[model samples]
Target: METGWRRVSARKSASRFRRSTSRSMEESTSSAWRVTHRLSSRDSRLRFLAADDSGSSSV
Candidate 1:
């Protein structure tokens, strides 16, 4: 095996691996954020409903 060719191939593979990993990370982060946002909104709505129900009951 030629040392120079091996080095070049290793570098190429490393760069390709980095690009793929970065893209996957971005996708996962976006999906996670979307899920978190959806959950938070739902929780807030439920809390609001509970508060409204209590206020009406007290009145």
Candidate 2:
């Protein structure tokens, strides 16, 4: 294999790999953030419900 051609091919493949990898990473990060946000909001709602329950029971 010619060294020049091999080097060019390798560089092209490496850049392609990086581009795909970064795109996937961004997608996963956004999905993860969405999941976490939903969970936190659910948790807060649960806490509020529990508090309301206790207060109602006391009254």
Candidate 3:
């Protein structure tokens, strides 16, 4: 009977760990996406500035 209880406890612990890990993974994925989006926006702004600079230099 004690062994059965231990098994049930272990299963519950494992389920909880899986749920926490899944939540963390989702958070990480969303954060990564936000970082990439910010990086891309910065890159686009730099490209526009460079184009303007070149155009002014040519004139």
Candidate 4:
């Protein structure tokens, strides 16, 4: 009877650990995406500004 109870508790802990790991994985992925998007937009803005400056100087 004690062995059966221990088995059940072990399974419960394993499932909980798996759930937390997946949740963390999802959060990290989303944060990474946000950072990438921000960087890309900033890069595009910088390129645009550079182009504008060059065009004005040429004119």
Show how many residue pairs clash in every candidate, following the order shown.
0, 0, 0, 0
lDDT of 3 by residue, 1-59 (tens): 99999999999999999999999999999999999999999999999999999999999
Query: Which regions of candidate 2 deviate over 4 angstroms?
Result: 53-59
Pairs with backbone N, CA or C atoms under 3 Å apart (clashes), candidate 4: none
| Best candidate, TM-score | 1
Write one digit per residue (lDDT tens) for candidate 1, span 1-59.
69999999999999999999999999999999999999999999999999999999999
Which run of 10 residues does model 3 get worst, by summed lDDT?
Answer: 36-45
Off by over 4 Å in 3: 1-9
- Candidate 4 C-alpha lDDT tens digits along 1-59: 99999999999999999999999999999999999999999999999999999999999
Alpha carbon deviation, residue 19, candidate 3 (Å): 1.0
Candidate 3 clashing pairs, residues 3+ apart or interchain = none
Least well predicted 10-residue stretch by lDDT in candidate 2: 1-10
Pairs in steric clash, model 2: none
TM-scores for the candidates: 0.74, 0.72, 0.62, 0.61
The digit string of per-residue lDDT tens for model 2 on 24-51 reads 9999999999999999999999999999
Residue 49 C-alpha lDDT in model 4? 100
